[model samples]
Target: MNDKKKKSDTNSSAENVEQHLQELEKADYERLYYSQEQTFSADELARSINEQRLTELMAKSDEFLKSLNSELEDFDD
Candidate 1:
C-alpha cells in the first residue's frame, strides 16, 4: 500500500511538472509568434532583436539546465 501510494504521488508530481512546462512553452511560443507578426521601426527593430536575444538566452538556459541534470543523473549510480 505504501509503495502504491508513493508511485501515485510520484506520477502526480510528474504530471504537474509536465503541465507547467507545457504552459510555459505555449506562452513562449505565443510571444514569439506575436513578435514575428508585429511591425517595427528601426528603434523598435533593435528592441525586437534584443527581445529575441533574451528569448534565445532563456531557451539556452533551459537546455543547459536539462543537460546538467542528465549528466548528474549519470553519476548517480
Candidate 2:
C-alpha cells in the first residue's frame, strides 16, 4: 500500500509539472504569433540609417577605385 501511494504521488507530481509546462508553451506560442510586433524601434531605426549612410560611402569608394583602376590601365602601354 505504501509503494502504491508513492507511485501515485510521483505520477501526480509528474502530471502537475506537465500541465505547467503546457501552460508555458501556450503562452509562448501566443506571444510569438499574436504579440503586437514593430520591426524597428527608435534605436533600431537609428542604426539602420547609419548603416545606409555607410553603404552609400562604400559604393562611392568602389566607384573611385574603378576610376583609378581605369586610369592605371590607360598608362600600361
Candidate 3:
C-alpha cells in the first residue's frame, strides 16, 4: 500500500509539471505572435510611405521631361 501511494504521488507531480510547462509554452507563443504582428504592421507602413514618395518623384520627373522637350524644340527652331 505504501508503494502504491508513492507511485500515485509521483504521477501527480509529473502531471503538474507537464501542465505548467504547457502553460509557459502557450504564453511564449502568444508573445511571439504579437511581436511578429507588430513588426509586420510597421513594415507595411514603411512600404506605404516609400510608395508615396516614389509616386511624387515620378510626377516631378515627368514635368521636368516635358520642360526639357519644350526647350529642345525651341533651340531647334
Candidate 4:
C-alpha cells in the first residue's frame, strides 16, 4: 500500500509537469532568450541544460521580464 501511494504521487507530479508544459506558449523562448543567435537553437538549449546554467538563465529571464513589464506599463499610460 505504501509503495502504491508513492507511485501514485510520482505519476501525479509527472502529469502536472506535462500539463504545465502544455499550457506554456511554444514561443516563450523568443521572450526569454536575449541572444538573437541562440533563439530557437536546440544545440544552445542542450548546452545550457547540460552545463547547468541555471543562474545565468534566471538572471537573463529576470532582466527581460522586467524590461517587458516596464514597457507594457508605459504603453498603458
lDDT of 1 by residue, 1-77 (tens): 99988877778777988989999999999999998997778997676577877899999999999999999999996
Best by lDDT: 1
Which sections of candidate 1 miss by over 4 Å? 1-11, 43-77
lDDT of each: 0.89, 0.87, 0.89, 0.77
TM, every model: 0.41, 0.37, 0.38, 0.33
Once fitted onto the true fold, the runs of candidate 4 whose alpha carbons sit more than 4 angstroms away are 1-52
The per-prediction CA RMSD against the true structure, in angstroms, equals 18.1, 9.0, 13.6, 16.8
TM-score leaderboard ranking: 1, 3, 2, 4
Specify the poorest-scoring 10-residue window by lDDT in model 2: 32-41
Give candidate 4's whole-model lDDT.
0.77
Query: What is residue 70's positional error in candidate 1, in angstroms?
Result: 46
Q: For model 2, how does the per-residue alpha-carbon lDDT over 5-47 read when each residue is reduced to its tens digit? A: 8877778777989989999999998898875574768887686
Candidate 3 at residue 35, lDDT? Answer: 84
Better of 2 and 3 by TM-score: 3
Against the true structure, candidate 3 reaches a TM-score of: 0.38
lDDT, model 1? 0.89
Best by TM-score: 1
Candidate 3 Cα outliers beyond 4 Å, as residue runs:
1-49
Kindly list the per-residue Cα lDDT of model 4 for residues 5-52, writing each as its tens digit: 887777877797887786675557665665555446687667667455
